[model samples]
Structures are given as C-alpha cells and as structure tokens.
Target: MPETTGDWAPADFERHGHELLATLRQHFELIRDVPVARPYDAAELMGRLDTALPEQGEEFPRILTDTWENVVPDLVHWNHPAFHAYFSTCASFPGMLAETMTAALNVNSMLWKTSPSASALEQVVLRWIAELAGYPGDSDGLLVGGASLATLYALGAARDAALDYDVREEGMSGPHAKVARIYTSDQAHSSVDKAAITLGIGLRNVVKVPSDDRYGMRPDLLESAIARDVAAGYVPVAVVATVGTTSVAAADPLEPISEICRRLGVWLHVDAAYGGLFAFASRMGGEAEDVSVGDSLVVNPQKTLFVPLDSTALYCRRRGALANTYRLVPEYLTSVHTGGTFDFMDLSPQLGRGFRALKLWWVLRSFGRSGLRSRLDHAMELADRLRELAVGDPDWQCPAPSRYPLVCLRYAPRGGVGSGTDLDDLNARIVKELNDSGEAFVSHSVIRDGYVIRVSLANIHTTADDIERLWAALNHAAEKCR
Candidate 1:
C-alpha cells in the first residue's frame, strides 16, 4: 500500500516500526562503525533542517527516512561500546521495549485508582530495588525522575520531621524561622545543597564537612559540626552521605556517619546515586557495604542498572516521614481506594508519575540477579584491566582507585605528573584528542585538586578490547603531546 497522508492504518504503523527496528538492529550491530558523537558545531546541523513547521502530514516511511538520515547522526550514541564518559547508562533491549510499552500505555501512576497495575507494580519494583541494594524490603518509597528530585523529597521529609513547626503549612517567612542545618561531606553530590535550598533550609545551612585522606566523611568532624551548630542555636536537620561521589566516586563512611546521625537524632539520607547498586551486582558476602543505614536512600537505575534515563527509586525507612512531608489531597484528587493501596502522589510533589516502574521491572526481569551480576562484573573487570594497564605503562598513572567501574588516570610519563609540563592542560588535551578521535569518549575529573582523566566503564556493549583501545589511545595522545 502507498503511503497515507490521512490517519495511518495499524498495518502500516507495524510495517514502519519494523523498518525502524531493522535500522536500529543494524545500528546496534554496527555501532562501533558510528562515532560516539559527532564533533560538529550546531550551525552545521541548524543550517541543514531550518525549514518551517510542516504544513501537512507526512507518510510514516518518509518520517522514518528523515529520522534516520537527519537525526541519528548528530546524537551522542551513549549505547555505543566506547561511550565511557560520565556514568555510562545502557538502555537495554528490554528497557527500550518497556519504553515503547509505557509510552503506548501512557500510564499516569499517581494514585492506585489511576492505574491499579502501575501502582501495584511500582510497589513491587521499589521493594525489589531496595532488596537488591540490601535495603529494607519493607521500606516505603517512590520512583522519581532522578536522584536530584529524590534528594529533594527525602530532605523535605527530613525537614518536616526535624522542625517543630509546620513549615509546610506555615511558611518560613515568620520570625520563628531558625537556622536549620543539613550536613554532608565535601565530596557529596550538589543535590544536597539543592535540596536544602528547595526545602527552605537555606543554602548557607548546608554544612560541608571535610573528608578524610581517603575522601570519606569524617564522623568526628560531622559530630563536631552538628554540636557547634546546636550550641549556636541551629537545629540539625539531616546528613546526606554519599555511596559514590560524583568527582572521584568516593563513598562517605556510611556506618560511622549513620551512627553519628542516629545518636544525634538527626535524619540520615544516603545519596547512593552512582555507587549504591554495587550491592545489586554482587551481594557482599565478606565485604558488604549496607547503604540502608539511613532514614532515606536513593539509587539511580539509569546509572548502572541498564535502564534508560530518568528513573530513580527513593526508599525511606520512615514511611510516615515521607507521607507526612508531602501528603496533601485536594477534593478533586480524593480517592476512595485508600483502603490498602497507597496514593503515590502523597509521597512526593509529583501529581503525575509515569510508568517508570515498567522500565525497572522489565530490565530487572530481563537481566536476573545472575545476569546483572555478570554484566556489572564485566564492567568491573574492564575497569580493573584499565587500571592495570595504566600501572604497567610508564607514561600513564591510575592515581585514584574507585570501588565502582570508575578509573581516574593521569599521564605522568616516567617522571612525576610533569615538572613544568602544565599537567592539567596536557591531560585535558589528551581527553580532547580521545574524544575528537571519535573512536571513544571519556570524561575528566579533579581528584584531590589534581586533574585526571575519568573512564567510567558501565555500558553493556563495552568489551575488553574497548578498554585496551582506550588505553592505547591515551598513550598515543600522551606520546603526541610529549
């Protein structure tokens, strides 16, 4: 049948979808052939498709053709094997399928009454994630867009619990507003500061406690800070500890921090956005790090859990705190299904929660515990291999060892980081050369004030060969610069 300008038939939709699938099949199979991202300027792309809005409907095939020809080239292929930049996230086959299903279903999972299956599945999926993280399966939580919002929600609950006044009902504009303090390690994600700001806890009130030599938060220092704040008429609200910090993947000593928070009567929220799932990959038999030692904890599935973008689960041990902080039902949203089912809207500011549970459920189902472990173990091994390569090579150095699949390396050559060599610029140029090579893409970070190249190996498609190639490229760039 010819292309239709009118409403397309289901048969044609199916055919076009298959065509797109065939294209994606080749795209994935031959992903290595494509660049990680086109290093072209916006003007080049903007100059190409600068046409006005479409006046009439186009055929599905033409739309597909346009997408493949015009759109796919410019996007950064995070799924590419060599995309080791940032925390590599993989939208697995099952995850993509789940996305399609979710979009088609268009589930508004705010309340149990809205979509019973969505809410029920969310409860199950949240519990499954908590268990995987070695957290309490009985913990109450909700899926959020990302860990940032999760932190905000968790902090909101913490604020409500710590404050004697009803900050939610009575605005902080009153003279009764006192300096409420939120303490976190210097290396924690900026989400902590953001959450404090959003919660009317004030950015100035978020104390940045210093970390130890290994970059873990010093429990003594945190205790001292809280004590000092208390003496100064400040209320200790919460402590945001990190499982894996963004800059160097340094995890704050949660056990000690949790003890401090609990003893001091302060709420503890773990920002395990990057490294919490280390538990999910391998149940630590002898060397386990339990992240559930907090009032609330957040883990991002998009980070290492083979899910697509924008999916984070915030689990709170104090279910009442989360519900109390955000629960407010207008007459319109009043649901009679409150018998046993939870209205997820009461757990956070979100009135319309997507069927994000589907993404996690499908990904979890597709890759069972053993399969997930194998994939994460693969990434971990590759990271170790890269570090080993850096050690063996005379021109490179892996200075900061990460517990996760994050490796921080700097080109030091035979000598130290280089006497008058401007090491930072050299490393930055090396990263530029690697990214410009289009063979791979890796990011950079500063550890202990020294600039270093960061290779985050978590992609499902990445292999041992890719690591070697990236290492070789690093050396090649170093050689050219030296």
Candidate 2:
C-alpha cells in the first residue's frame, strides 16, 4: 500500500494497529502463566519513566515497545484468571473493539443535536439495563463515569427533592440546610460520605445505621435513627441502602428499608455497584425485588458485566426530580430541538460526555442476557465451592455468608484460636505470603475485629481448576506463615 501524506499514514496505521492487536492477543493467551500480582522497585521503575521532555517526537513502535518493557511487568494483572482480588473486570474483546471505535469517532454526546445516534443508543441501553434489573418501565437513567459519580448524582437529586426550596438556585446556604441529614448503613461505601460532604451536608449529619449479624442493615435500627433525627428537628433527606457491600458482599434488607423510606418520605438510593448486575442471574440467589422499590438505583457494568471501566448507570424513577436538580440551560447551549428528546447534559453533571453507550451496547449485544446470567451463575458456583473447601478445613473459618461471588475466610489454626499469636496478624501474614507467591492474588478485609481474606470470583476466564489452584496456594501460604 502507498503511504499517505499525514502523520499517521494509512499504511502506518494498519501496521501499528495490527501490531497492537497481536500484542494483546499474545498477552491474553499467556495471562494465566504470569504473576497475578508482582512487586517492583519503585525507584528503579521511576528512573525508567522519569525523563526530560523530548525535543521531537519518537517512533510510535519504540514507544509501544517501551510500554511493554517498562510497564507491563509491574502491573497487578486484574484480568488474570487467578486474580481473585476486588471485583475483577474482564473487558471482553467485543467491548474493547467498541471502545476503540468510539475513540476513533470521538463524538461528544452531551446534546442530542451533537450526536443523535449516540444519544438514542444511550437511551436504549439505559432502558435495557433497567428492564434487566426489574426496575419500573417508566424508569429513566443516564450513564456516568462510575458508581461514585452515579451515587453523587443520585444523592444530589435526592437532596433537591427533599428540600422545600430550590437547592440548585438558592444553594444550601439557608437556615434549613443545617437541619438536613443523610442516612446509610455502617457498611455503606465511603462514596456516600463523600457525596454528602460534596453536597454541603456535614459529615456529622451523615448517620450510620447499625447492621445485623449478617452485615445487612437492621430496619428497626434505621427506623429508630430516622425517628430520632425527626424528633431532634433534623430533616432526613435520603436513605442509601447498599445492595452489595464491599467488605463481604452483604445485601442489605432492601424491602423493609425501602418501606421505611417511603413512610418517612425520604429519598431511597440503592447502591448495587458490586452486585446489581446479578439481577439477571436470579436463580443463583440474585434478587432485584427490593431494588425495584427504591426511588433511585445505581449499577456498574464495569464491575460485573464484563465491560471496561467507567460504565455506570443510574436509574431514577422520579425523573422530574433529577431534571429539576441538574437542568441548566445556558444561552450558548440553547437548542430548538426540544420536547421528548433528551439532551443528556441536562441530566448529568458533565457538559461534555464520551460515547460510553457504544461499548455497553456491544457488550450487551455480544453476550445476551442468558450469556451474562451463565457467567454470573458460574462465579456463584465457584464461591460456593470455595466456601465448602474452607468449611471442610479445620484451619480455615468462613466468617461471612457467601451471598455473592465474594468469599470472606480467615486462617484459624486448630489450637491457635486463643493462642498467643494474634489472629489478625497471622491472617495478614498469610495474605502477604499469598500475594507475594506470584501464583494467585487475593485481598483482605476486616470484619468483627478480625482480618479475613476476600476472594472475589468475577473474571470470565476463571474456572474450577483456577479455584483449586488458589485453594492449594492458600493452604501452602497458611502453613508457611504458621
């Protein structure tokens, strides 16, 4: 092929694109053979990366080679089959292709007029997600960067809806602002606190409702807290019910919590960042019944749906409330294309948005609902098997119930329960050893003053063999640490 006149000539583009794809293919093929997590000398790696500004452009191929040589080895492989750490993201190939195409187009779909197809596709994808999750047919949603942003946007709408005055126009400067409060489970994600802080609701006003033995929020305690706040002249603005907590993957009792919120007229936001997509796998103990009752819900495709990062959908039943909270039509952005057609900028915090819907659409299309359900079911089965293995072993104790794919277990020797060795210290040692072994990777979380290993199974490539290997690795590491 003849070279074009521009910087990236047609011939060069094709050659480099093929090289990138080939490199990715090779990496994926041998991913399982590499270390799940590896430690690198930070100073040495920094020496390779830290350099003076280049006077001129370097060869693209050399840059790619440097990335492979200097970066790939130091990464904690999240896509590795044995990566049983925090919720693993697979980034399926179809989704990757869609993302590449989206980048090539680089259309900002902030307004419908800016990119009509992108806006329409996003609306369609949002509806599909809501339908899959058993939300109301009338529910409306928008795609954001991730669950943190989604929660913030949802809480912002909730705050405005709860306030008697227009918070968007007047801000939270009035006397009434001092009395506003937000409620969430003690096990809720830190994003809830961040959202409250960003919204001018002091951290003191964020009440943490107690949890039961199973780690699910106690409805009785939540109701009492709300009542006490009301008696103290505090207006409860919103109640965030976590569907899948981070520590142990506990699903809060959403039905009772939603009922209490409804009676109290408090905005209910369900944070299902880790477990919401399980709605499609209802047979494997996934439930969306409680989620259906909430005023708003947030689910992350990036976490569980095999999509790449930054694809979170926030569904709001009260669409008017969201529009009223975030709608800002500046003179420069005014358009005659009105009614029924949505300008996404009106419903989100960002005025310039990428074409995130393309990747989500591709993921859903490639893996139909049944395919996704099958993958989720497989992960649940793996968790069950792991729990069985831990229970069968006398040295291991399963601390929490395996409601989802995340399994929490701790190392407790036969005679070391009340021995001199601190259980937390021993478990920490075991985790460190396991991570350092370069065979498999797992994370740790503290529950009830005890450190427990958190092994999450969400990567599509993980199999029974991988779990068995992890089981062996855990036993070996525990013995070595002991």
Off by over 4 Å in 2: 1-6, 285-289, 417-420
Looking at candidate 2, the ten consecutive residues that score lowest on lDDT are 1-10
* Regions of candidate 1 where Cα sits further than 4 Å from its true position: 1-7, 283-286, 415-420
lDDT of each: 0.86, 0.87
Candidate 1: RMSD to truth: 2.0
| Global local distance difference test of model 1 | 0.86
Least lDDT summed over 10 consecutive residues: which range in candidate 1? 280-289
User: Candidate 1 lDDT, tens digit per residue, 1-482?
Assistant: 44445556788768877998898999988988898876778998998778789766666778788888998888888888899888777788999989988988899998899889999999899888888788998888899999999999999888888988888778666656767889999888888888888878888999999998888899999999999999999999899999888877888888888988889899999999988887756523335457879899999989998999889999999968888978899999998865588799999998998999998999999989789888988888898899888888777778758768889998876665556678888899888888877888889988775899988988988889888888787788777776
RMSD of each: 2.0, 2.1
In every candidate, how many clashes are there? 0, 0
Q: Between which residue pairs do clashes occur in model 1?
A: none
lDDT of candidate 2 at residue 413, scale 0 to 100: 91
